[model samples]
Target: MRLIIAEKHSVGQAIAQAVGGHMEKHDGYVQVGDDLVTWAQGHLVDLAAPDEYKDHDWDRWSLDTLPIDPTPDWQWKVSRDKGADRQYKVVAGLMRRGDVDMLVDACDPDREGEAIFRRIVKHAGVSKPMRRLWVASLEEDAIRDALASMKDETEYQGLADSAMIRAKADWLIGMNASRAYSLVYNARFTVGRVQTPTLAMIVDRDRQIAGHVARPYWKVVAPMGGWKLAGERLDKREDAETLLRIVNSDDFAFSIFKAERKQQHDAPPRLYDLTGLQKDMSRLHGLTAARTLSALQSLYEKKLATYPRTDSQYITHDDLDTLRGLTEGDRLAAGFIEPDAKPERPHLELTVNDAKVAGHTAILPTMQADKAALDELGDDERLVLTRVVRRMWEAVGDDYVHDVTNVVANIDPHWCEKHPDEGRLLPEGECRFTSRSDQPVSLGWHAIEHAAPQEDHGEEDEAAGNIIPANLAAGVSIAPVPHGGATLSEGKTKPPKPFTEATLLAAMEHASRWVEDKDLKAALDDDESHSGGIGTPATRADVIEKLIRTGYVERKGKQLRSTEQGRSLIDVVAPKLKDVAVF
Candidate 1:
């Protein structure tokens, strides 16, 4: 008999159903044929509290208990989360069952999932033969396939070690620093290895926005027959007027110095990892990372999508056939997908990389979703599912092809001579103007993006400029229209925008750029999964939510601003704690 342990009750039920038998439901487990399935409500067993350590007075929030290092002799306890204790007992009871000769670790396929199962087994003090059931989707077929091809649990020991080290490091930093800082300030202050650096970034950006000073500048633009050319930005209005007068004159003619056209192809974007999905949802629908994650989890449980917590943006070689089917038929039947929009010559290879897909495949819609009624899903779930479906089709799309034309010209010599003072102000006695435009050769992947125009929020249309004439080539001279005189446009430099969840998520993902040390930055960037970020995709949302929950950060509409308390914490935090690399 086998005992299958899942990460949650919904997942447990899915596994039980996939096991194929009349399931006998119990208090917290289900008996299916000769096998039993159980679950943990997240981390049912976690590191013990500081006070639980008998050797230290770590319970008292004092500076003396500054560093809570519980290494080598670390203790474990049942999580205080609701019903965690009861669930632990149920799982432990099953592990001790005499008939259950084999154990199956069927938790979510990730580092945290590995840690969850290991902690429980160790806490229960039971030795049994163990196997791992790793599946990316909760669909019945996928689950059954996983059950039939289980691997020995020992294969994932490296992943478990990494998870444990990360957990302990977080615990030591959070416990020690939070207590030390809170005791020093006489107020409750929570600090974390990842959360502190993330908070520091917000606080720094807020400071930058607050301290910004806008500078004014002017530019001269001349209208040609079909297109407009712009002069360089001038620091002084008088300098701009010099160029303006030269272009406004009827005698003004352009000597085309350089005109070049080249064809360019924009490759389609890769598939959505969890972070990428969260960022897009925040940008497109104004959904929080936590909300997007929650919706994705629901979709995963419904077997409409694959696992939700993956960091990889590509699938393995084994998943290519499944991906091909997803690209065809109604597998991705979200209402947002246009009926005519199909990948006739899908580039499935663009989304395949065996080495990159460490555990779970990229977030994808399952075949089961093709027949499921999507409208029956909750509002957020439906919205999230729509995005996932759209992205799947978009990932395999052809390249967007376009021809870009760049032209640079100089005002006629006669005009410069007509206004000698203005000519002298110009660089090398010539006023230069430049214009660029892109003409679409093929819409390709852009067709999908264009079909769902509402999905793009902040993206600027590259092809929105005027059409450049084919005859306007190098060495050609054209007179400026007498009707449209050159004019000076004045504008002020805009301050950087505040951090929205989308931009903030991006900043967190590429945080290696913030580090000054070359070696440290390289070290951070070396890990493909992290991509130089402080936290994993699985933990980043929780870190953001924790910051908000603790009143360190506040959401003002879509913008995330560091609160007064948050800034204060950053201000008082030890310099090393605020460093991204130090974490």
Candidate 2:
């Protein structure tokens, strides 16, 4: 007989179904034919509390008991949740059952999941032969495939160790620093391994915004047929007027000095990692990162999507067959995919590399989601699922091909009146102007609206010029028209917008700038860095939510702003704890 332990009851049920187990339900567990299947509500066991350490005053939150450390014999206990302890007893009882000979660690396939299973087995003191079931999707075929290919549990010791270190580090910092700072300041300063530093980033940005000063500027533009070209921005108002007057004169002449047209292929976006999905959800639906994660998690549990906690945005080369089927595999996705849409060799190669993948491939829709089922989901859930499905098709899409034309001109006020007969004109010095535009050779992925269009404001955006057709070539002289009407328009600089959860998460992810030291910044920015981005992908949502729960951050609409209380804590907190570099 075999014993199967899953991360949760729903997953346990899925595993049992895939294995063709007999139905026999019991308290905290169920029996399936020759196997005993059980589930844990996340982690049934965790590190013991400070009070659990004998002969220590760490239980009290006082200055004397600041740095709590239960070293050497670090204690472990069933978590405080009533269900956890009750379920732990149930699993422990089954672990000793004479009928069961082999143990299967069927938890979520990630570092945290490894930790969860190891802690349970260790606490129960089970010494049976153990195996692992690593599944990227909960779909029946995927589960059965995983069960058939289970590996020895010892293979995952490295992952389990990583989780252990992460958990212990979090406990040490959250326990010690929170107590030390709170006692020193005589206020409840809820410091976190990730939360405090994240809060510090927002506070720093606010200070920069508060001190920002806006300056004024001017520019001159000329219209030729449909195209509009802008002159350089002039610091003085008189300089802009001089250029405008020169262009306004009928005698003014200019020649297109450089006219170049180049075509390039634009590649499609990669598949959605958790962070990338959170960003798009925030951008498209105004959904917070936490809300998006919650929706995606629900989809995963329902077998409509793959695992949601992954960091990789690429799939392995081996998953190509399944990845191909996913394109038009289910009826719901068929409607969104182009009829001829299939990922080409080049496209597949771009998104498939075995080396970088960890835990799971990027989030994607499963074949189980049909039209009716997809429609039954909430609007946000449907939106997320549709995006994943579309991205699968898009990731393999043909490149977006287009041509960019850059036309440069040199204008001379006196040359037009004197050299009316001349077709080719002067050297590079006088008021230089340039016009640029892109022409599409093929719509490719853009035809399906695979991604939203983001506007680009180049240097010539000063006067909001139009994209001129690629008509005028080098040495071609054209008379200036007033259609783009010259103006010395003045505008003030603007402060950076406050953080929305989307931008805040991005800041955390790409936070190479949070610190000055190159090595330290590189470490923080690394996905596998000890304290990357203030928090890991699994915990960042909760970190943001915790800030709001504790009033360290407040929601002003979709934007996150540090509250006065939160700001005050940063103000009085010790320099090292709050320091961007040291922290």
Candidate 3:
């Protein structure tokens, strides 16, 4: 008998369906054709914690065990989670069967996915001819194709080795560092390879916000018809009033000394990767990053979407026809595409850089782009699916078009970078006052945004207030009404805004910015490096959620702030452990 073991139950079901086998449901598996198919709930086994080690010294919490490394004889056991033991027994039983000819690793196609399958097989102590079934998409055709081309598991040795090393390294850092800090502070401070650096970033930002003291400043605005032009800010009110008086004089005229008008275009947003989707979910629906991942996991399990853990925002050439058909068939999304929108050369060519794709393509809908499928989803799942569908349509759609204009008024070119008398003498001349305005030439891909069930960008555009009539030209003299909404205004300098979940996720993703050394920065910023960032996309949400769970961080509205305990941990923790650059 040929036995197939998938990473999850839903995947197992999909495989059975794709192969068209009669079903005989068994203990923790099902039978289709002559194949007995089973699933493991994520990982059935994990490396034993420090307490489970043989020596009592390890069990004791002290400074002597500052760094723990797993030896060659390190132990593994069934996870303590509820159903792990039961599922482990079932999978092991199936693998040990006399009739089973070979074992198939039908797990996820990434490093962590490789780790999940290998650990289970090793723990069960079942040796057989191992085959790999790697599928990027869960569509019936894709699954059948993957099965027909299954390769020996030996091909993934490098990926498995990398995954093992990462898991052990994280365990060593977390186990020793957490205990050392916890003992030193007399509190169970959870320290980790990624979580520490991520928490430090938030704490540093909070310090800046706390240290800030607001200062006052002044600005002058001139109202002309429907448009408003603001002069540069002045340190004092007298300086602002002096400029206001000059402009308020009877003979003074507003002339645009410089003007530029050009056509501008915006391509649709890149497709959803795990991090991008998490950021959008946090901002739009107030869902935590962990919650968003969980929702996406459900979608992936039901085969409604492609793999959710992929980092690549690009697809390969093989996915072109699948994506183009999806856009054409989706009724709600079809209108977003232009009548002339053909999946022709350049536009379809944009998403097909083979060098950028790895493991899996971008998150996309399977046959589930069908409008009828969305009816059974919950509200949060519904929102996520809607966005996924909308993004697909937008990716291949036309570029949005805009007409932009820049108007500069009351110019004196020599005033800037010109101090004629060696920083001392004569009268300083008036300076240029500039403003920008944009007119929408065409909606293009953005035409469907109004009809999609997506969130509005929470803030109005900063430059939206400056738009003017199309007929306004350079060198035209316009009368100024300085009294209405355009009078002199005074305000206080504000502190930097706190870090919200969406912004925090972005910071964590681009964690290379936290370090300054050129070589180290390169190491972190290289997206190709599997372990480049502080945490993997698969684990970043958990790292963030763990910080909150352990009292190292707290949520205020949408902002994530360091608590008193969290702040003190940073203050007292050893620099080598908490330092973002080194850690």
Predicted structure with the largest lDDT when compared to the true one: 1
- The sequence of per-residue lDDT tens digits that candidate 2 reaches over residues 266-290 is 9888888888888777776788888
Best by TM-score: 1
**lDDT for every model?**
0.85, 0.78, 0.77
* Tens-digit per-residue lDDT, 408-505, candidate 1: 88875666677777667768533677788888998887776564435332412323465888877898878766544777878777667889999888
What is the model-wide C-alpha lDDT for candidate 3?
Answer: 0.77
RMSD of 3: 3.9
lDDT of 1 at 203: 95
Give per-residue lDDT, candidate 2, residue 407: 79
CA error at residue 165 for candidate 2, angstroms: 1.0
Using alpha carbons, what is the TM-score of model 1?
0.95
Quote the lDDT for 374 in model 2. 77
Task: Please give each candidate's TM-score.
Answer: 0.95, 0.90, 0.91
Q: Candidate 3: TM-score?
A: 0.91
Which regions of candidate 1 fall more than 4 Å away from where they truly are?
A: 331-334, 417-421, 428-430, 451-463, 526-532
Error of 1 at 382 (Å): 1.1
The backbone clash count of each candidate, in order, is 0, 1, 0
